[model samples]
Target: MTEEKRIPMATIGFTTEDAREAARDSFYLDELDRQAEIASNSIFHAIMRGRETKNPHDPRVWGALQNTLFATICIARLLKPGPVREYPGLTKQQSQKYADERGEKLRKMLDVEDDCHILDVKAVRDAYEHYDEFFDRHLRDVS
Candidate 1:
């Protein structure tokens, strides 16, 4: 058998604890999605059966128009988590790994040198600094 060299792989920045934390977050998000979908489907089914339009803006037949507000909220939460990513349960290793991968992708995305006068190293640095702001801005504010 020939000996083969293997590269040392860096962790994705998630510890077992971090993985658990992420898993919890993921579970909550999934549950939120499920509940929202179910409510939407119910409203859709009701409107279909009723076959009456309360308002042009109102999709449902003559139900309390206010209920639509709750439905809209569920839909919004499904799309965006609001500002709730605050608080704790965040891990440094996990954060670092996310930052590294995000940085790498942003760096690799630059096709030309000095597109922003960024050398490869500078590119990674720029990407690193930009990632959080980019992520935050892109983060769904309503959902």
Candidate 2:
């Protein structure tokens, strides 16, 4: 019979918890990468759809632009230093503040000289997301 050799846990220099933490970190990074790739693909599809129509006012073109905008926002948020979190109780202003902080962190990390324009998409996103309220406000103003 052949003898089997095994390394002791002490020689490994890391606890099982450390391994678990590392695995969790890796999984998080992989998930972020996957989401970014999906967003990129959405942007690519949007570009292709936009190219298919010459009229900017076309519904297809508008839809594509909307997708591109949302995708860009996703990518921008992904660029932030840590995992994204959802604060269900946060108000709109608080949420915007959090986003601004994340964007600033990313910009600083990247050594960007100019403002991160991608962060500015929140207003456009909000308008689209709350289109009913936006349209109602506009109608009220017009009346």
Candidate 3:
């Protein structure tokens, strides 16, 4: 006669101790990091392109996309099982305060978590790679 072996549900253990937890946490952490980097670099590049274009209106064109990225990253940060849950959405300020605040929050995440960064390096490179050639070489002119 053969008896069936019952496996416990919700078991966090794998072949290695804490390996599952580490892998899960690492996945979320990577995602949070990726989202943050994309948000950070998107606007940073937009701002830089604005400067290169020498136009005050350049960034305005990217406002919506920037806002979306920030919101998405903020959500990812909140979901990462840490102190980032209360992240406030970008404020609707008339001045540059909104931009400044976004930049500050995005960069500051690196200090909170060791494996995190101001922006995802790959996302930044991918975002800007051939940016000029593919983006009409104008980056939606500010002026």
Candidate 4:
């Protein structure tokens, strides 16, 4: 008779150490690093193109700039994982709060400072999500 292997399910709300440990060892970390680098470069190139265009009203320039910022935020989110979202044990609100706290630390670690142009990356993301009309303003006038 052939032996069958059984994968153990979570007994309670806690994630299995094996799963977390596997994630730590996974190539996903390396991939995330690579993706971050690519997104950074993309932002730089987009800004360069915008400058070269020398036209404030150029849609291509504005589109690239906006897309890059959104891409950067997405990459940042991928780099920050939440235990509740990945595993279990917390309410949705609690999970979101925990993720937000971690995201704040990540922003600081990345030296993401708010200024006249960009008050907050997360806020920008939220605005983009909650208000489509926000984009109607001239991109050049964004600042």
Q: Mind sharing the TM-score for model 4?
A: 0.47
Q: Which candidate number maximizes TM-score? A: 2
Off by over 4 Å in 1: 1-15, 52-68, 81-143
* C-alpha lDDT score of every prediction, in listed order: 0.48, 0.62, 0.52, 0.60
Better of 1 and 3 by TM-score: 3
RMSD of 3: 15.5
Error of 2 at 9 (Å): 27
Clashing pairs in 1: 13-93, 13-94, 76-143, 80-143, 81-143, 114-117
TM-score of each: 0.32, 0.49, 0.36, 0.47
**Considering lDDT, where higher is better, how would the candidates rank from best to worst?**
2, 4, 3, 1
Clashing pairs in 2: none
lDDT of 3 by residue, 1-143 (tens): 89999973453456875797565555545656666566666767766666676556665536635654564545433433222222365334422454444344544544444355423333554464556776775666646
Better-scoring candidate (TM-score), 3 or 4: 4
CA lDDT of 127 in candidate 4?
Answer: 75
Candidate 3 residue spans exceeding 4 A from truth: 1-17, 54-56, 59-72, 79-143
Q: Candidate 2: lDDT over CA atoms? A: 0.62
- Ten-residue region with minimum lDDT total, candidate 1: 111-120
Tell me the tens digit of each residue's lDDT in model 1 across 19-112: 8656655554555556556656766766675666445565454243234334545434333322333235557665555544433433344332
